[model samples]
Target chain A: MQTLAAGPPPPVTPLVVIAIYLGLLLALALFSAKLFRGTSTDYFVASRSIGPFMLLMSVFGTTMTAFALVGSTGKAFQRGVGTYGLMASSSGLIHAACFFLIGIKLWAFGKRYGYVTQIQFFRDRYESNRLGYLLFPILVGLVIPYLLIGVLGAGKTIAGVTKGMFPETFAATGGSVPSWLTGLVICMVVLAYVFSGGSRAAAWANTFQTLVFMCMGLLAFYLISTKLGGLAKAIEAANGAHLVRTPSELEVASKAGTFTREVGVPSWMFLTYMFIPLSVGMFPHLFQHWLTARSAKSFRLTVIAHPLCIMIVWVPCVLIGLWATAAFAGGIEGTKPAALNKVIGGLPDANVGAVLSLMVKGLIGDPVVVGLVTAGILAAIMSSLDSQFLCLGTIFTNDIVLHRTGKNRFSDKQVVLIARSFVVAIVILTYLISLRGGNVFDLAVWSFSGFASLTPLVFAALYWRGATKMGAYASVVAAMGTWLYFFAQSGWGGEYTVFGGVMPVALSFGAGALAMLLVSALTPKPSQATIDKFFPKF
Target chain B: PQRLIVLLAIALAILHQDFWDSDALVFGFMPIGLFYHACYSLAAVCLWALTIKIAWPRHIEDWAEGG
Candidate 1:
């Protein structure tokens, strides 16, 4: 296994590089703030001024969070190459479908009616203020864990890469900056920009960060593969080490009594995993990003290019994770083999979140390269954080605050102030909760499953004019209730599947869709005015 | 064109379940299942670009942009 030198204190170059990267991001935020229009519309949705490339960047950036980079690498480290097929490729296809099918329609609705939050659209579509009230807390509850994933992931990556750099000063944490401190700093940095320029700043920062991470991801892929003796050699080594097995291979090996691991991702699980990516269809943050488009034409680039972007970022991370399994097959050097036996410590008990960082630090020679790659990972994490923070704040201000205390009561500046205050409050709250860390990948899957279950509501709203208020209410209640039941049954287990092989997302999504269809069929159709408003004839 | 794109997307989704290639490898290194999906993602890119050029909702653009 590859290893850094054992004796001397690790170089501080990576930390300095990361500090510089943060400074650059803060500077970019300040620059964006100078261009801020200082209106609630501008603050929440960039005043619908973003064009194609920036729109594509921000949308893709926000979607590709710690879950994609840190979480996928960790999952691949534990699960093998099937992890890529499980999420990345399916996400590439489904996320683009959502952008084309759901995103464009929602953007049109938002522009036509001056809507800034998803709850606002839901309330109007269902003609029920109570529906908005029901959705607000549920959406907020689901998003908190998503936000926690980013915060926890950023802290893990930063600490893992910078370990042993400050041996004397931080001896307690194995010479590493603590995860809590790192998380706090990350929360504050993301808050700075989102508070300053809101959605526009987030878009600008996401564009820059997306560029940084994609470039750095490719660099990390090349460097790590080279360090492990090239891509072919790395794959060959992983295959030989029994770390890269397909489901059929595992099945055959099991029959021959040569393999004992839990049958590499079952065919049923693999097929049902497709439902998880549909979560993008109902992502509140994505809805906000969609509303930022300058024209319907702005979506063309996003829809077309997003799949390719997923390919670029995900392929390298998955390959690196596969390689890490082989590279560390003999266990991490200088640590006991039994203690650090598996590459990422074995499934449910593993600190899988730090596998990518551990691989980067252990193999790469130059601290600067490590710093740049760490910054890249941090960029992906923070980019999503900014958008989620802004969206949550937008939802609070628009759905709850303004709805309760009439919109006319608050001036435009006051509305912005309310949003900013909520952003700060959520940032602090997420940071505090992040300290009680959980598995990044599992938390993300649970959060995404919750969102996926609600997609039936969005689909019905846009396509079926018969969808009524009661149907919408029933859909939300059924979906979330199913989600809670499955979540409780799973007991927060990482590889929790329903019916032995199927993902819980499939069950939740089905329950929601069935309720939406059945209830809508039994109820009165939506008013003609509402139908005409949402589905105008050309 | 829209129908074609929708049909193509559904076909692509079905093709995504590449259980047949699970045990095969390409170039003695890359798993065939993973490689197939990589190719599948690229195919999606092409199809989506075509959708934008041929089947994009022009009326929505016209309305939003005041064309």
Candidate 2:
């Protein structure tokens, strides 16, 4: 978006803006902690004090993340405009369905049984504490990659915004801020709020960040188009020679085109991407947030307003990515002075995640505006990271440590301490793993497949009378084993795709549902009493 | 009303079917297929708003505080 257009090296405005943003976040964390009652319930569920508007903002904020803003934009450059239909539209409808079908029921059960996590729900429903031995690792394992996406995304964005900050010292990064330092800074800022205020602070902070990213992102869109010469002119410049161009005949590739093997979306693959959103039905972070709702009425705003919020964030990101393809078609801006082209030219695939920031800096020619957009992108990312970190810590404390040893063995304060400690450990581990190279969007899709496969377990747990303990076990194994098989078969998904264009999640989803059905039928159903607990006669 | 909500979900999926997304534009600036979904997104929010008003399970809202 921002090419190295003729100008002084972009000022360190973004670095200053990011510093201001992080400082504000730390202050918010401190204030929320001050309001904390210092109870485990207070830490874990925010004492269930969140009202409707706050709940809606926090849930939508946590769900959006880098995937909605950065990943969608970057992926669009590679995949074309079909990226929007594949994700944003399906997500608009499917996510609300999950909130209704799973979230509300879980909250009611949580209030009834004093449950705070998904593991607690399953373990009690199946009458098996040993389920955690199988579940905790799988749940935590799946979530870490998703967490890495947020951290890695924030790092890449900051690196772009502050390109000249360490130009002399970091020769390879073109003096851009390095990702590792960026990652550490974000981890620390998120940890500050989550460690002290826990779920409540995450909710309050997410509400604020969600508003910031949305408003600032739209502003970036307006200013970027104006800088390129209004919306219509900008679109014409990018589209006439780039993505919006329709080929005469035959699905052929061009030097400017992002697609390699195919020119347009495959029919079957387009159909199956819908399954991807089903993963939210089982997301542990979402589960934790659902429990923090003050009442089932609180879910109303989230279910109704989520789609509009998604549209506001995604439309600009996707369009910007598409335009980048047209703008950087030659791959090097030889005619445009090197200083002006420095932000965009010469990077392979044009670095999709950083497009919006580059567009701001290169076009608007204002440091403060670029910095504001960088903060917005980081806001989209960090909002999700805090919730995931807090959820993992909660699962460790509630499911593994307390379930195995004894719930009463420790005081409430001690339990809260254990959760915070685990969150810190997980953050460090994820940040290290993110240092290795990968496409943020592809890696995210791989991670989503794992959770998508596990959705059947929750669906059956909530609604099916025929689901049994052995059946749940079989479903988990079948889904995960299929995921691992496909993940490895593709050589870690570098050239991954099923025999047809179908996504791997569809196959695993079928296997999981079948396993639950057949195993429950053969290996005896749970007593009607157990069923009665989950399926009460209301 | 509940049936209408279920129908809306089906329509949402079908509306995004993407069978013929290429070779067209809308408003002289957007692809016809992508443009269709952009409007679909707005409609989804409206549909869900109505569902919340008419079809959401009101009994669930009656959660006993100490349950």
Candidate 3:
């Protein structure tokens, strides 16, 4: 069985670094809180005070959760370089398209109407109170799993890095930090910031975390590659193991003892993966971030720079994962360094989420470097968690509590209090559910698929004046119903794809779009007043 | 100009498939398909910058700012 590296006990440097990082975030949140105007709007959307740079960082940071870092690395290890082509490049294009087409328009509406949640805009556009009621539960349902992904990833990553540090005390957990404790601490750190300063804190924290993770990702990439003999040598080793083979060629290679795993991504699956990035258009957290923008001009930097940022972050991670296969193969053949072999002695197929963490720990000798990289990974996870927690809170307060009790029924203080209470509740619930554990990448893809299915509604709401409330209803029902059915049909399996190659997102998105078009054509047009309000003549 | 940018975006999407480079390696090491995408992403960044300059819906911004 694989075990932590033998020798002297691991140092506490990584744990210390992570603690200091969390402390800095708390300090930043406290500083942001001092600047808070104490109004619900200021709390929820930062009073639209965010400028271009911060807005770019926050939106990009929030969209990239554990799904980008931990999940991508694990997936790349399981698959190959094709993993980057599947998600990163497509996301670069599609995500920017959403930011340009959907984000700006929604920001305009929110600023004009004093709206804080997506359900408010949908309710006003469709002129249906019942729609908000329907959407609130669905949006919250999807976000919970997303929150779980972050929490679970944090636990697994921290535990993986800190292995052998507490050989006697944490002997029950293989001398690593227990996931439950790590998860609880991460939850509390995130909750402290979001509870104190809301969106502004999230934005500030995201900007800082984004910078840290990017730099540290590069550092880890350089260090790991240098340790593995260099990028060219690393790639050559992986190639010799046939680690780059496509799925169709994998069986033959494996039978001939040239490949050890079916590690290639298929073509159809790659094409369909583009649909997953459309989830951004319908992300409630992203909607909240949009409303925080100071102006539509603020989005220009985001739309243009986002793809480049994705490239910078994803290339290193995907390469690191690809190199891991070579490293492991070489270790088995006695061709690798002893330290590297000690940590990653076996294929991590059973728990691929730990692959990136193991690679960092195995290949990098300096405790400080390992600590910095672990902190970077945790930053990526918590940055997204704070925004999600705050958005869910904002939705519950505005769409459910305030909408049901009547807006005039509560003072600003009471409203903020209600939002805070719900945020706390969600943080606890998500933390609890995360303990059940599932694959981070698979869970994230499933969550994004559900949101992507709902993108048609956002598109129609913004641009299509003829889109009726019934059409919106039909679109949502058809999309979510199909999503749930396929999710069940897959038996909740992470590898489940449609037609043996396509992602389930293709079917869900199609069902939703078709429902929107047919139902909108059959139903009465929206009122002229509503159309004029939403799509005013210049 | 707006129509041109939209067409260009569609073109970029199509170019993203890069199926021909699937098995080839660049620089004797890097997967050619992956390198193609790295370049493709950079191209997207340029395209989007051009879109912002030429195809942005300034009218909506004007309305929002003016209001």
Tens digit of per-residue lDDT, candidate 1, span A415-442: 9999999999999888878888766556
Q: Please report the candidate that would top lDDT against the real structure.
A: 3
The best candidate in terms of DockQ: 3
Clashes (backbone N, CA, C under 3 Å), per candidate, total 0, 13, 0
What docking grade applies to model 2?
medium
Rank ordering of all candidates by TM-score, starting from the highest: 3, 1, 2
For model 3, the docking class works out as: medium
Q: Which 10 successive residues of model 3 chain B have the least lDDT summed?
A: B19-28
Q: Is candidate 1 or candidate 3 better by TM-score?
A: 3
As a TM-score, model 1 comes out at: 0.93
User: What tens digits encode model 2's per-residue C-alpha lDDT throughout B13-60?
Assistant: 887784442435567666566687788888888888888888877666
Candidate 2 stretches with Cα past 4 Å from truth are A1-9, A168-173, A240-263, A328-350, A435-441, B21-24, B63-66
Q: What is the C-alpha local distance difference test score of each model?
A: 0.82, 0.77, 0.83
Candidate 2 lDDT tens digits, A121-197 = 99988777777689889999888888988887877787767666665777688778788888888988898889989
- Candidate 3 chain A lDDT trough over 10 residues, lowest sum: A248-257
Candidate 2 vs 3: which has more lDDT: 3
Higher-DockQ candidate among 2 and 3? 3
* iRMS of candidate 1, Å: 2.8
